[model samples]
Target chain A: MKDVFKPEFVKLELEATTREEVLRELVDLLPVGDDKKELIYQRLLERENLGTTGIGKGIAIPHSRTLALKDVFVIVGRSKKGVDFNALDGKPVHLFFLIVAPPYDPKNRYLITLGKIAEISRELTRKKEWMEIEKKEEFVKFLNGLLREKK
Target chain B: MNKQLLFLISLQELDILIKEKEKEEEMGFPIKPCEELKKAREKIIEKIDAHLMRRYERLSERYGNPVVPVVDGICQGCYMLLPTSLISQKAKNERIHTCPNCGRFLYWVDD
Candidate 1:
């Protein structure tokens, strides 16, 4: 999971104003071309159609299990000005965990990775640490420390 | 994107959305716009060649996905190793091509 959140893939400051824009911004970070990016965006929207992935506490985990993905990947985006994501808590979302994984991931690693992100989010929310991180390295280091502590 | 590619991709997206909606229904969550989406899907089907649409539907009924991505000369749907000749030719031609092993319609996308 630590390797999944590469510094290059992290957006410390998001410029998206809406849920769809945020999703597009995150998908743009992936190492894929235009058509695949479009497909990924469509899959994300389809997942959102089922139900909002914004689980609350200013965190939104927008994910898709799709054949378009070659492997499990994570892209983190932070928005100082929160976007309206139709979250369960009826609040805006500032932290986004965009996860993409293959449809037939053998170990179901996406679920486990998602759980880890959610756990980290819960702890960060409790300490208001997610709000204070300003650099991508800081975000990565904080999450790494949390994962180590959880063990 | 070419018109054919665009059409096929839209159909694939629609089919996946329909399946997801059905799954949600199974989980007791009422899906929205399913009927409207289905009707729209029918219109897209009509836009496709009658013969090709029929083939896609028949295969879809059997495999759940008639169209799949060709990743690195391999059919992601069936995991069959495709011929380099076929893969290279498909890249040159944007039209639909079915995997020889699984008969699933395949499209090429960058990895």
Candidate 2:
């Protein structure tokens, strides 16, 4: 596990009204100035258009690779009321992991993040624990613990 | 066997189970699975399988003709650079080697 993720990068209580709304909100959370905002937004939109990021089990991992950033940043969000995300499970999504990485990176960090999300999504779905999480720090701690897991 | 295969097998089993339940429901009494329930189950299974298959095929080609292991923090698939600590820790068998760059699970292989 690399130390690429920081606590500040995580966003909690994202008030997204819909799937598209959440996607836009996630793009806004990326660390990019006005000069690079549009470029990053477009890249993310392009990836979404390619396919829905909803991985079912009420979770979505939206990610993209762009030159707009110097490094990778991830944002974790939760919707208390759940948002219509077009998930295959037909359940509203409450968990989201939005990732943005530099295009020049030799490896596919996006896929790795997706894999990590997938691994946890299955367990979380089984436990239905997303609804039980009450505070933002708790969410962050859960993710940190997950990152610390061996293998 | 890849993860996609596992997903497909699980989905197929669910589909069959749902159908059996639906047949029982049609006999007059409601059961664990019904016609409407079976349809929904089939739809979900199809979507998941299609999504996984599409991604697996696309990524398999993008990385290389054959899937390569990430070993000693290096992408045996491409021999790209990885973190020194990652490789060292993996060499000591203290932790699994994941490509710092690719994030794929690394495996030690002899050529």
Candidate 3:
């Protein structure tokens, strides 16, 4: 419902080869202090340990609600070579959607944003060019279009 | 950043994640079991002070999140402007703060 996803948050080139590194790399995109960023990454790792957010296919959604953030934010990252995230289907993860939310989300933006991401993920399988999109704007536009198609 | 305050912060983080997972379940998404989360919460609760625990519970019942971050001298819980004196503390996080307007425990986000 909210256009929390931005082209600035999208990175076409992710250098991490492992799950931990990928999550850390995504957290680096946040515009916050170093200490706050570390707290968000730690909370993210805890969530990943509990269960893989990789709903299978080349996607992984690493998320957490932490006191470190003041609002809901989402970062979209992609790796040319997939990283092992201990996904549900035991496949390498090429795309990452990291969602970090403030502990006290009055409008429940985090959950709504998450639900929107899941909806887009479901439509990902049919779109083969998801990873092929070059420009960040084009990539984000394509993703936003997927959500629009749902309606 | 005392031991009790540290534990309380971590406890609140765990609780938020647990609540998120529960919300996910209601939205028809499958989530991991909550039993493990409950165990972790119990472990943290055991480490916090008894009196602090009661205060946290009482505040949580009053405000969904008993612990919140102070961003630029504003209480994120109730959006009330915190006193500048408290904000200018040399060692703010050394002791937890309660918002005068909302009474929720506040930690400095800048630190």
Candidate 4:
């Protein structure tokens, strides 16, 4: 699979009212079949039960792994009004990046995705521009622009 | 030398020196020894303080905690299983992995 991140993975104009709802909606958007969908959803729910995914600063990345996938998928969401996600800072979350990958892969592609998101997150967290971005299309375009700039 | 022991000793020494300096100043003595002790205390404190500060910063950047362990594909820091796609990509060494649920940098620790 290519390492490139595409804009299609970005979901603009999300209507998810809560974090869990957002995760479920994002999972539904993936191309996986029904048999795998439950497994993926279960993993995501289990992961959340362990701890709150809110990393503070209005961003949350909800992810899960399952054996039913052949490749990685990323879903980006933006909530202009922010959702109460129980963030460490007790602030609402405005951005989300959901990652889903297959289990039993030899290369550990999950780690790379973690690193990439962390890199982008660090930059986005520092910039005031990201906080001001209200439109979903603008948010997706900004993320795509960041990915392109990385190259 | 054992690092843990050294750290404990340094902390103890600092506390004692600070107390002695306080006593000397209270007595209105020459205060020269107190000054020397204060200087030494500052040096050690500076080194240790900087080390701890940097460690916390990195921890916050990576796992949002000083020590994070992944158990069964879950980040102990944030308790997110990480994304399956990220796991596959990271397995290939194509990118560094992070938990999408928490946005904390993920690491595979062999424990």
Candidate 5:
């Protein structure tokens, strides 16, 4: 998680007001070029179209496995003003965890990280303290705390 | 990019999604088979060149990925260096190219 989760990928306050915009904003956090970013964006959009990754509890995990990605990437974004993501519980999503992985995942890192994010989201539902994190660094630390809690 | 090449990229994405979802379902995941995605694949199959489709099928049977992106002159499918002539194409995915090492369809992931 330390390798993938970085302060550079965290946004303290997301500016996108809609789900599509939010996905694009998260894609911008990726350390890839424009062509790959577009590919990743399309992959995430397609994944969302199949079924909303908005697993509710004020959080959403927009994930995809694409040839464009060389390895696993995780992005964290928070919206002060939540956006409707067609979530499971019909709630607007205030937090986003975007996962992008290469198609050749020998270690199942994508699935394992997804499970961890899902688990973290469940823990997030129990408290609103994550909202207090104003700095991206603080947010990463807060997430790291949640990841540590799962151990 | 050419229209057929564009479709190939989309087709690969659809195939990946279908494969992932199908595997999840096989593992007793609560995912239903997405018929819509399968139908979408059929539609794409009709538009592809016959010879290219044949090659794709043979490679896909051998390895799950038939089409993969090229980054830094490297084939993500086989992780081998692509030829300079192939990687030097400035137009970016305007023509169909296959990795000499693995024979998987290649699309440039970086312009």
Candidate 6:
């Protein structure tokens, strides 16, 4: 699970201004082909339409289960200038966690991964750590340490 | 993945959206017009092979989904193990493949 959210998947500076662009940039990090990427993007958009995945406090965890993927992959992107992601608190989002999983995962590991991310997001938001992220490694270390503490 | 595979994937996505829209209508939810989905489906159908398209329509009519991913040589749609001959590394990708048991379009999810 720790390997899923590696440093390479972490974007220190997200350039997208709108929610849609942010989602697109995050999807681009996935190692899927163009068609699968498009399908995943559409699924994410559909999920957002249901209600924002932005769980609040400057943190958003957008996720979906799709046929486009085989493994549960996580991509973390941070927007220095927050983007309005239609969060529950109606605040701009600085930390974005995009989690995708195959629809027919036998073990349903992605659900557990999503829960972990939500918990981490709450902690990050409460501490306002997103604002203090000066380096990608720092954020990664903090998240990994928090995740380790939960075990 | 070939262009045909990509087309099938896109078509599958459109069908899913159409199904969702229909389901929303069935639940009496206030839904917007889905003309875009309809048009997108038509466009994708035109791109794929006619025989494959016909098979997809038939399967979709009988079942809710006409396409499913293959994970570790197992069909996600019907949970059936695909033949080794079909899932072999040397199998040609020039033509599209379907699950023999459930007849759903198959896409390989190589981890």
| Fraction of native Cα contacts reproduced by each candidate | 0.10, 0.00, 0.33, 0.00, 0.17, 0.17
- Maximum-lDDT candidate: 3
CAPRI rating of model 6: incorrect
What residue runs in model 4 are displaced by over 4 Å at the alpha carbon? Answer: A1-4, A128-141, A148-151, B1-111
**lDDT per model vs. reference:** 0.76, 0.57, 0.83, 0.57, 0.81, 0.75
Residues B33-59 of candidate 3 have per-residue lDDT tens digits of 889879878988999999999999998
TM-score of each: 0.77, 0.53, 0.91, 0.52, 0.88, 0.69
On residues A1-151, what C-alpha lDDT tens digit does candidate 3 reach at each position? Answer: 5555699898999999999999989999999978778778888897787777888888888888887777888999999899999988899999999999887677988888888788788778567698888999998888888877775
Comparison by TM-score, 2 against 3, better one: 3
- Report how far residue A6 has shifted in candidate 1, in Å: 2.0
Give per-residue lDDT, candidate 1, residue A44.
Answer: 87
* Better candidate by lDDT, 1 or 2: 1
Please rank every candidate by TM-score, starting with the best: 3, 5, 1, 6, 2, 4
User: Every model's DockQ, to 2 decimals?
Assistant: 0.22, 0.02, 0.50, 0.02, 0.36, 0.18
lDDT of 6 by residue, A36-111 (tens): 6887898889667755777777888887777778788989999889999988789999999998887545676766
**Residues A1-151, candidate 4, lDDT per residue (tens digit)?**
3533555666656788887787877787778666456556766664554345566787776765554455678887777778887666789888877877654235866646655675676567777486667665676677767765665
CAPRI band of model 3?
medium
DockQ of candidate 6, scored on C-alphas against the true complex (2 decimals): 0.18
Model 4 docking tier (incorrect/acceptable/medium/high): incorrect
Against the true structure, whose TM-score is highest? Answer: 3
Model 6: how far residue A124 lies from native, Å: 1.5
Per-residue alpha-carbon lDDT of candidate 1 for residues A12-113, written as tens digits (9 for 90 to 100): 899999999999999999988887788789878966875677877788888766656678889999998899999878899999989887654668787667
RMSD of each: 3.9, 14.9, 2.1, 18.6, 2.6, 5.7
RMSD of 3: 2.1
lDDT score, residue A21, model 6?
A: 98
lDDT of 1 by residue, B48-67 (tens): 88877888889878987777
lDDT of 5 by residue, B1-111 (tens): 667877777788788777678554433233335777788788988999999888888988998788887877888789999888777768867788888999988877665
